[model samples]
Target: MPSGHANAGYRRLFDRSGLTFGAGFPLTGTNRSTPDPEAEIELAKHAESVGFDGLWARDVPTYWPKFGDAGQTFDTWPWLSHVAAHTDEIALGTSSVVLPLRHPLHVAKSAATVDRLSDGRLVLGVASGDRDPEYPAFDVDPDSRGELFRESVEALRTVWREDYPELEDRWGRLEGDLDVVPNPTEETIPLLPTGNSRQSDEWIAEHGDGWLFYHLPESTLESYIRQWREATADKPFAIAIRVELADDPAAGPEPLHLGFRAGVEWYRDYFRRLEGYGLDHAIVGLQNDDRERAFETFAAEIIERV
Candidate 1:
């Protein structure tokens, strides 16, 4: 189950048996953009201390009032760097960065720098832009994002693997002179494509080191896992799950839009079923105000046992 990169994050994710869990940020789970920064850093450290395998950050360039969630409220690189300084052993990852909104060169340089700083613990998840307003904001045509995403993924591989390799793309042209440095701690970092990003499933399985998907229904997820396994044997499949841990251990599962509200035993069984169906990782987001209690309880009862 090696995902080509020996980076700690990649290994922790793809090289494991069954499913391991990670905490998604903001650990506080506030619906708004602004969160207490100090609290977030502290919770991040606490999450690692309690045996979570990884910490994930989201890439939200701007806060849209209509969308109602600003996603960790900090640029992915700087915020993750701050957290990286405080924790050891816990892998750091971008739940995803929107590739179509950014210049590939900048994305490569920033990601590689973080990979180096984290000592090969970074797992980069990339995606095409989703919001329609975002396309206009970035002066990009909405229809062109799919191709842009493909080109960005290609550009990232080129810049990271070769020094000043000649390439031309929608963003710019590279003439084999200037290079994006400092190289990652490994030969290159792993690139997990989030969702379809407007590409065919075959295209994602072909190019992605792994796949980052959102929560899906049981039968649908099982079907997706089957398709992914058939296309790329042993490539990782991960999803972000919203968890509401009920106090009673015996509580049955009550579904949320993209996750579940249940007690530890139910979640344990639920994750085990997903693991049995070939899911490698579950990025859990605790949607409770008492995040500390929820995190500790979830880890002790579910993560420890599972």
Candidate 2:
């Protein structure tokens, strides 16, 4: 199914079948404090060169010690812009920007700027924020995040798509007088609401260009896809999974974090099953001690072969 957006990056990633692959950023391995910038860029280039369709960046506003994940340890805007400068064709995406923590105008403006600069390569994944401490630090009420998230989505769409949209929401009021300049490359930026954002499935289906979800069991994933199809037609569905590719081609599945440890053959079959179940894309986090070798093995085995 084709994505609603006509942008090349969007089309290349979402408007395909048979499980298009994407690499998650920082492209560095887990439990790392800071990513090596030069190596990360090289890896990003490698990912694009190897026929990966997209690269995903996460939004972690303030790193919480308790949260235990630094999330690329770079601000999303500048990070994406830097990545855009380095790569040519791969789509750039936010794993999710925490909407309630940021004003919609800023989110809209920054996103539009990246979209234009990247030549329409941005796909925004928005969330209602999960970290409890971040809410107080940002001066947002955790209980009200769901409402703020909905309002922010509305505001972002209005500012991007309408020339002088009149909006009177909690974010602020625009009287149809001033406009947010440097509008997106497309009429509307593709928005994929991540994990419901505290809204109903019907709401996400109606509002989002697609759905971005975490890894789920096969049966559960199929059920979710079936429900999504019932809610809307043609919108894409994407999932992110953490994978550790085993050396032996015939190695079977073993449990890992949010994904599994398996051989190329097992993954090939697993992804084919996902494709059969109507999945549009899979964003993979390669977990290995050797990053470059892991990427090469994945490309040679799963990506190129699958």
Candidate 3:
């Protein structure tokens, strides 16, 4: 949270929690037919005011029209820009931009712009895209995404940190004295790879600044964390989770993929568990099963509690 924004509140909260807490956005009102950007901005501002560490946005291309759970359901860059302009202190993150479906040069340019605009609060999350519908539209082979994703990441680094370097990659080639303008602070944006994306655990630990994983039982989660720590031996780790709150604190566990449907007390206890596991960040996606009630209830009982 040591961002370009000159807000000491950001620094204080980060220092006190020793963990990054965030909320995913595009708060689609359950009964509303479409998203309202203005309303969303208000929600984002509220999240920041309440001392959340970061805010995450998801890219939902095509929505497949039926993915049912389109987190942000918007173009990644535009949404990030909108949020970055409005927020003064909280770190802005993309859950991930599917690298294989995009040109890394474009990503590099756009991300750097956001970083500069936000005073260096951008943390890019990249992944080998899933959702087969998008592959055909982009002319990207889903099967080859792993290789393309790897190459794109390399290309981004070249364009950002080097000038006029000879670049050779499966995607294409670049030569001459050229570099992406307005490089991000630190000379690079932190690249957090979601899941494995066909990269081995060791490979991820070696290359990624952090690993993004779905929720898991603490023991299982710790095992994966241990593997990453052993492999990296010199880097940090990050993790995230999704949760749906029941008005009742004892609502009990209901099955949710990579997450859970529970109560405020349960959520706080679980977050404490994750922190105990040495997680540096936790981005919670508030499920939309009950929309308004869920948002208000969780924000009051759980979000503030954490």
Candidate 4:
């Protein structure tokens, strides 16, 4: 198997040599249904201009208002394509696309299209979805999501790697007579399975090109990284963290749901420590009122220092 460096998006976000960083969307920092798209675009451009390695988006097929956050509100493919058109070299990614809700072939075509449009800067982070209502909304059986997720992943790889590949399972059959077009810029798109997606650690280690996890406590995070390193050789391990940069440069870390609040200096050392533990990448969601300045500040202080 070829390493992630073979894929441009994967290369931008991961390196066996050290850890890299990316910024996640809803960059506007809005928790509501409508985030300012124009503002988000400018922030995306700003992030790239300031040397952020990648720009990531979320896939929320249907927003249940109860969920509280709308996650960028735009559908994944077109939004990423639009971003691709505006940016030049920054990697484009999905924080995750729910695999079980969508047909594998559609995911293949859309993902390949983004990869082609972006000149191979697309890296897929796929998940099985968490919301209970979301499954029934898609006419998907909740109990079978694990199987569906596995089948979807295998299907994606098969279609991307082989032209008109024969495939059969939950979604009918492809008889090797018809093909999905616009293959990924590499032999295969970099596939990072988000969280467990109902799969075991062993399954994720074997099938995923990388692993995307949420923020964990320092000890737990270190343990996961160590276990991942032992199980998979050279594959990247990534985490998406919510960041709240305190005004004090030396403030200690306080917990958030999937991340923490701390001073830039602490973050710098924390990331360095993570790098020492063999972590490869981090996707940050900046939770600050003045996010633009926070981005510049973090980039200058934390990113540069790290």
Candidate 5:
């Protein structure tokens, strides 16, 4: 894919070489409970001020206690729009929207609205619905989610790029007589399919503008990046990691949820290693009681150094 074809958010958050770092939303301490709205906004501004490339928001329509995370506890569209209004320059991303749970047209409209509102700072990350309980609650078939995921991606592209495009699929049909309004800031918003969305690697590589992956060990991540490079030459590859910065600057790495508890020096090395493997971006969630200090430390110690 040509670099110029992507939206500002995509370009700002990714590059052909090296890695850009982004901060995940709900920047307050990790309690999984509802975070203060005011504090979140403040931390968001702080993140951009410190030079983080992007800010990510997750989509969790309903709270599933068993799942153990509320994911910002708000709808992705409004929450992102709110964040966009409060900050400038920092890219705004949907860590992922659950595509199969919502209609494609609705997703298209909401995504484009945010993109336009943010002046092309929306990088949409979409995923097949993962929570089993969400399937029946939304009256959607879990068995057909893979197909729905594919169709949703196709529908979004059609509605965004074409005027009243004729699109017929398992979801519904667009007759070419009606059009979705509020096109994205660019020709189309960057669509990054998350964790394969139950689709084949070939399907994802062919359809997605980029790919969003979960945290993996260094060796495993290298293998995945090698495979991704083989599949697509220029599309970006991003991973999300839960990071806890140890106060001691030289503390060795200790395993945590999907990431690590390490000193600042270790993080710098880790990010450099990721860049060496051709990883484009890292969405980091800081686990700390003092969110402000964490942002500053990460900016000075890891993001800047890397």
Candidate 6:
């Protein structure tokens, strides 16, 4: 496939319909429990069956004592690898991997491996480190993550694109005959940026394949997206919603940090507004206290509705 200009995966979610929706991890750490992929696989298959555009996995390197939620409680890559084989068509993604914490070369290698195994259906999202506790444990400075993230993205691009791609960055060197084998199906894989990561608008506009924005009201979503367009002026914009769906359509809106609790009707209406706002994608974060019930209800209700 020709890379960098336009491709099927990018065009499907980022171009056509102007609305790409995907389910975040159905499990977000409740009830002293962790997500079981075997159990989750049934739900994933259901999602694919129901026509969700994609499924996103997250990387939580540590469970912080201060942080109440435990996330999906699995290393992201292994989970993605397992599910990629189990399902047939749904695309796989990472809401984000903390790039500053890992070597970019390793990330390139792993991403390429998953993309190859899945037959070129990997969309990698990356970000600077957020958990303050994690930075020290890895002997990396949280304050300097923005710089590291830029370096990491650049390094990964080099390794993915050219054989022993020449390096001229603050990160390091890839001197002689080194190369990352099995370059992505496209000349490169899509690298979606999460948040600002301390990058200037120019840097983001120039480098980011797509942009991820967190929690915005319908109107706010419109304004932010407009601003992103004005800033980047040429790139695609993707947004994420932290959603908790209730069984009843009239359950009303309750507050979560970056999301809300609403019923299926409201969910549909709200998403429609986002589509009108020119939002390209909405990655829904499902944070149901009841795991099995949440997945089942969403599949029957919203996923089926979409």
Per-prediction CA RMSD (Å): 1.1, 1.2, 3.7, 1.5, 1.4, 2.8
- Candidate 6, residue 19: the lDDT equals 67
Query: What lDDT does the true structure give each of the candidates?
Result: 0.88, 0.89, 0.72, 0.90, 0.89, 0.75
Quality of model 2 by C-alpha lDDT: 0.89
- Clash count, one per candidate: 0, 0, 0, 0, 0, 0
Q: How do the residues 138-253 of candidate 1 rate in per-residue lDDT, one tens digit apiece?
A: 89998998999999999998988898799998789999889899888877788889988999999999888899999999999999999999999968999999999887889999
| 9-107 per-residue lDDT for model 6 (tens digits) | 565466554466777774433313576667678777876776667888777788886776556677777788888888876778887889988888888
Task: Kindly list the per-residue Cα lDDT of model 5 for residues 1-306, writing each as its tens digit.
Answer: 245565888888874346788988778854378889899999999999998999999998888889888899878999999999999988999879999999999999999999999989999999996888999899999999899998899899899999989999978788989999999988889989999799999999999988999999899999999999999978889999999999899999999989999999998988898888889899999987788999999999887788
**lDDT per residue (tens digit) for residues 54-162 in model 3:** 8877766666655565656667788888998888888888878889988888898888888788877787778897788889998888889889988888898778778
Clash pairs (backbone) in predicted model 3:
none
Worst 10 residues of 4 by lDDT: 1-10
Model 1 backbone overlap count:
0
Per-model TM-score on C-alpha atoms:
0.97, 0.97, 0.86, 0.97, 0.97, 0.89
| Candidate 2 per-residue lDDT over residues 55-141, each given as its tens digit | 999999887888778888888999999999999989999999999999999999999999999999999989998999999998899
Clashing pairs in 5: none
Better of 3 and 4 by TM-score: 4
**Which model, 1 or 6, shows the larger lDDT?**
1
Error of 3 at 221 (Å): 1.5
